[model samples]
Target: MIDQEDVAALLGTEGPFARELPNFAPRAAQQSMARAVQHAITERETLIAEAGTGTGKTFAYLVPALLSGERVIVSTGTKALQDQLYFRDLPRVRSVLDARLKMALLKGRSNYLCLYRLDQTVREGATFDRTQASQLATIRTWSARTRRGDRAELAEVPEESPLWPRVTSTPENCLGVECPFYDDCHVIKARREAQEADLVVVNHHLLFADLALKQEGFGEILPGASAFILDEAHQIPELAGQFFSQSISARQLTDLAQDSLSECNGVTGAIGLVLEPVEAMQDAVRRLRLAMDALPERGPFHQLEAKREIGDALHDLREVLAALTDVLASQAERSRGFANAHERAALISERLDRIAERDSERDVRWYELFPRGFALHATPLDLAAPLRAMREQTQAAWIYTSATLSVSSSFDHFARQLGLEDPQTLQVESPFDYAKQALCYLPSGLPDPSARDYTDRVIEAVLPVLHASHGRAFLLFTSHRALRRAAELLQERVPWPLFVQGSAPRHRLLEEFRHSGHGVLLGAASFWEGVDVAGEALSVVVIDKLPFASPDDPVLQARLEALEQSGINPFMGWQVPSAVIALKQGAGRLIRDVHDRGVLVLCDPRLTTKGYGRLFLNSLPAMPRTKELANVQAFFDDEVSAPA
Candidate 1:
């Protein structure tokens, strides 16, 4: 067994990483985290390690995990990060260590192309439009040649194309082992590889899906690993709430109706029983969405009852779905396709009934409207209990690490959120010299974030900073409204290229921004974290406000009310800590490496106006602070004139 000392030696200055990798710079922080992770693995202890930006946390964990020779599952925040770790980082680490470890990458089933669905679409000649037909043809061509069938590999097809849904399968639609293409199933292949591998890379969604399965009676998708390292672990609490929550969407209902009709194509006399009710169910869904148009985008379930039309529409939907469920139940013995459809229909009907019952004490029943559809959710008020239960059931070492895990140097809030009772915690500060490489500039004289003209004022203040930095900056906003406004105002003013979020795929926009050399990118939410642009390409990160969860959200409102009822100051106990963590994520985008120098422009007046602002400030990397715009300009000025 590899001990903590062995883990340390591999990461030390004279170790394999340092000797073999040309760009690997040894840091005491990385070694410290490696040892901690090694210790956690050896003792099978719960560890919460907060390695700040530039700590090389990836290598820190990988070394110990690869050396420990345990069946390890590494879960990241997103599919992109999962791919990065598996396809890029893991191979490098294994090669350097010469560790003979088998590793595999697994994602949610939706990511892989379902050959069954593809063939069904092909045989049915289901073509919505010319573009969709072309896209499907492209997928068919690529599907034949692709080994993994991961949709991410097909660069020719855009992620948002409607054709993807027709060709890919969800849990509700998958025929599983009964499928004709079961022998060639990509998802099963991926899982089989993961089950046999020593290490598996996955995203949090897949990890939580497995955790959620214990309750769902669907057994886990992941291998029973000896250790689970959840990198970007800060996303866990919020994500756990989502995975744990029981949600049924309009799309699911419509898909069920459509798939039921598709299943009737071959079966004799099936269409007569299924087609009319399926269409009626589809119509009910449309009526429900139309009725919901008069209400707020989302709110407590009671709001549906408050509006008589919406209530009637929802009732109509339920009756039609129940009718469809009964019909499908009659056809269940006809074919595997019928059985799957029947099961999905019955399950959704049951969920709708369960969601209808008011469970205010534990779960919050809420509904959210979309442009084309809607979703009803029943989220738990207390996520900690379920989360803790998941960890205990695994009986494996749980190591949670992220740059933004702790708030104001305290893990209490995060710990309480995830029910990490006295888990061994470690905070390794970023090895970057923040004093020399970074500056924090809090803009002065801004109205409250609630003010109607807040976005306008923020842009007015940021334009000059953009000019000073020569347009190499990320203008991150808490809301899309602010981001759009800023983009509109700067399009004509800024001389450099402007890359706005939603204008293109995130990766493409980032690539353009990086290559532009002096580009101003306006983004919201997703840009806050897991984005890396080091050196001179990015020199400034301007946050429009403190990254607080909007109180308008149904989940946040319900959570806060629950906290208030429990005698906690919801703002300080929950909101403030969460926002501080978010701000750190946004600010972290600025200084990514030791050589990277940049200015973090915090436009939120609360940082100085409120007492709790210190929490946000303290949580950030220590950097020289100033309120003067001249200071920000001077910082960049020095960057330009400094010796290379």
Candidate 2:
């Protein structure tokens, strides 16, 4: 068994990792983090671990997890990271330790191919464009030979292809044991394997879905785990809010209508009764979407109901959904499909009533519009109590680790958010010599981020630094509008190849940027973190503004109001700390590896002008601060002339 002492030795310079792996330099912070994780797992207690960049945090937790002789569920922030951990990091550690343990990777059901759905699609002979038909054909061929049925295995199909919905299953549509393909169901197989595995890798979506018992037909996987190690754990609070919230979407309504019609093909006379109500529900959904066109993209539900046309449209939708539910209920006995449709309709109707007509002090009633759809949500203002309850119910060690979990070097905000009361905590700083490896450049005399000319002036300021670094820089913005403006402004001014976020897929854009070696990449929200560009490929990172959540956001607005009602300064208590964490994530992009040398430019004048800005600066890794443009140019010059 791997004890606390063994945890340190195993990661030591002369240990198995050093002998078996290449370029395995021992990091004290990594070893310390491993020991803390091992201790937490052994005691079965909750731990909040903050492992900074270059801390080898992945290996730190993995070493202890693989050797703990316990069933572990490791949840990552995204599917990409989940894959990297399972396929890349886990194998390396398992091989080095020679630990005999079964491991499996499980994703949300949408990621897996539903054999029954595919068969139905093929039999129904649904009309499709030539491109979709070709994609369907390709999926058909791949499904036959694939073991996992994970859509990720087939690269020929784009992730956003509409055909995927037809081929994959959702909890509502999956027929469970009654499914003809139950024995060959990919999602079931994945969960079964996860149940038997000693270690399971899942993204936050799957983890929360299972915890909420939202993924029906499968036994709960989280409660059975001996330990839950949530990496990129900072995302949990927001994700937990989403999972715990009640939501109804236009897509769900459309799916229910379409699925009811699809089921009619199996039962004689079913189409006669189901078709009209289903079509009516579809039309009602369209009408609601159109009515919402006059509203903002997103706002409080009261604002939505305030408009007479929107209120009427919502009423029509509720009535049509109720009509469909009754129609499906009348036809429920004919077939299993009808029964499922009936259940889905009744549930959706109930949800629609709750979201549209109900009021709750605990929940934020909000509506958001998409291009052709909308979602009504009732998100809870307080997740702490429920999160605490879930943690206690599992009786498992909970390990939450992230580089940016703390603000101003304190975990109070994070702990309170999750209802963690005095849990064990660890903050292992980065092993990198930040003072020597990087520079923090706060550009002088910049307008407030709210100024109309802020983005323009930010571009004007960053151009010289980009030239100094020979165009290898990331200009990250807090909003899409700023990113677009910066992209347009930089196109004519910069001579380097430009890689804008929306111009290509993120992966493709990052690939092109890395290959360009001197490319200037402009991006927004998604680019703030989870991007790794080591070496000279990225030497400058310019953040256009502080990443404060917009007060205009309905959820944030509600939560802030609640805080104010309770006599807390919402801006200091909630907004500032959250923004500090976000800024840390953005600044972290500059120095990813120990050898990486770069300059981080903060164009938001608030960093120096605002009192709370000190918290953001203090939270970042200690590095030299400068306001002179010459200093940035000289830093790059020193890097270029340094020893090879």
Candidate 3:
């Protein structure tokens, strides 16, 4: 029998924590969230929660999930957390509760090492140079010893190695059970573990990919769990939008073409059927890349722009792909690999034609160009219908929780966006003493955020604060260009271990930052959220400007235009709330633990000057605000001088 009283006691102050450790103190907010989640699971209702930082929301949800006797599938935002959940937190909780449970962690296909692809690439002699040959040799050695066949186990092989794709599988290229090496597939083994588990943890990408699989009648993970718990749930609308959209990229096409050619080489009649079309597709991809190179840096292009000169190129490429599809169709039945390739080519051809046609009223069609390639996309303006359909189709309870899910403690923005109907929302504030833990510092007399010299001025303003904090600061920027500019200007001026994003991997940078004793890490959007640091190592968080989603982005523009058509104020309805949630995330970095003390510096003057600025301020934790550098220095001084 499951015990509710025991659940309450474990979450209470004088319960397991109080009995186990002298330093343990229970959080009421965490207990409240636990009760709510338990209630949701009991009633099988769709629920939303905005549990702030330090609420111990993970355990709050996990404890109830374990006790409820419901098979729960917990979805996180990243794979790093997915592994952490399975390897660390879940085991800790199980031990704490002394409950026996079977749990599994499942990531997407690409994370696993494909034995089939690895064997084919190495045995067929795909390497062209000595460096690649050496890399293949290293992988071969690792594969023999590795039990799980996870590529992450190979630390010596650099992340940027081109040989990784050859050893991994994509959805389009994976031959699935049809492959000769199906019995030994790493991905399949992982999925089988997940299917047999009482509880499974997955990332957001895998969750949506599974949802798509269910919709399309394919094998997937986490469909039959009794309850679904989404941590970092604010990302749902955006992630759902992506999965619901029709997208086909040049990279996917290129990879498919290359893999098809590689897989079909030895088969009879493969040369004429595969070689000619693969070469043509490769040429077309190069042409598209070359043509798009003339366009500006990565940004959205309208249908008219796509249809002009670039439109002709898309048409020509689609025709070539179409011809390839015809060639593959006749020979596909002979080989499972070639058949999958044919299906992918046909889908790509249809989507390209649809993207070029741009005739769907319900869908907003656009394309983005990268330096090397581009992708065409069609997103539904509203995801509510489909999202609601998904909720109805599944018998499981849906619980969405995140630190930044609310606008002014209301979940309407999040709920309406995802089409959840009357979701029971509970906003649990962080138990941390925010007033004592953090200070919001706005630099006085700074130019607008869009000014060309704004980064320089922000750096100039932050110099004094950085000095006070003794180089333990995160200089977070909105764009890479801004991060580069600020890093260039500050690295020479600051006498600290300066770690810039992309210098090393994100985790490595964070790890070094913590170990450095004193280091200033400059990073962009990725660092702004999902970063957790506590205590003296991080004394300040300085953001160059308020993180407003770029207006030039295709999704933002589409959303704005869609709102305008309906005569809703886009700025209030879309822009302001969205920016507020992001700003809250950036500011949230300052106060992680109850003992954490820092100044959150938003150098943008718009917080005080603009009419919509209060929304951002109102959304953040209610902390003391200041516009002076002296106050920040004094705050740090008082903390340093204070008794431990």
Per-model TM against the reference: 0.98, 0.98, 0.96
| Model 1: per-residue Cα lDDT over 1-644, one tens digit each | 88787788888888888899989998899999999999999889999999988889999999989888789999999998998998999989999988898889999998999998888889887546888888888999999899999999998889888878878888888888888899999999999998889999999998998879866778878867889999999999889999989999998998898889888889999998998999999999999999889788889898988888988988898999999999999999999999999999999999998998657678989999899999999999899999888888878999999999998889999999999899999999998999999999998999999999999999899889988999999999999988888888888888999999999999999999999999999999999998999879999999999988977788899889889999999999999999998888999899888889898999999899999998889888899999999998898889879987
lDDT by candidate, in order shown? 0.91, 0.91, 0.84
List model 2 lDDT by residue over 1-644, tens digit each.
Answer: 76788899989988889888898989899999999999999999999999999899999999999989989999999988999999999999999888889999999999999999899889889799999999999999999999999988988998989999989999898898999999999998898898889999999998988888733445585448889999999888899999988999999999999899888887988898988988898999999899899888899999987899989999999999999999999999888888998999899889989998779889999999999999999999899988988888788999999999999779999998999999999999998999999999999988878889989999989989998999999999999999999988987888999999999889889999999999999989899989989988999999988899977799999888888999999999999999998989988898888789999999988888889889989999999999999999899889878888
Candidate 2's displacement at residue 347, Å, is 0.7
How do the candidates rank by lDDT, highest first? 2, 1, 3
Candidate 2 runs further than 4 Å off: 214-219
Clashes of each: 0, 0, 0
Q: Candidate 2 — which pairs collide?
A: none
Provide the lDDT at 108 for model 1: 92
Residue ranges of candidate 1 with Cα displaced over 4 Å: none
> Which candidate, 1 or 3, has the higher TM-score?
1
Least lDDT summed over 10 consecutive residues: which range in candidate 3? Answer: 298-307
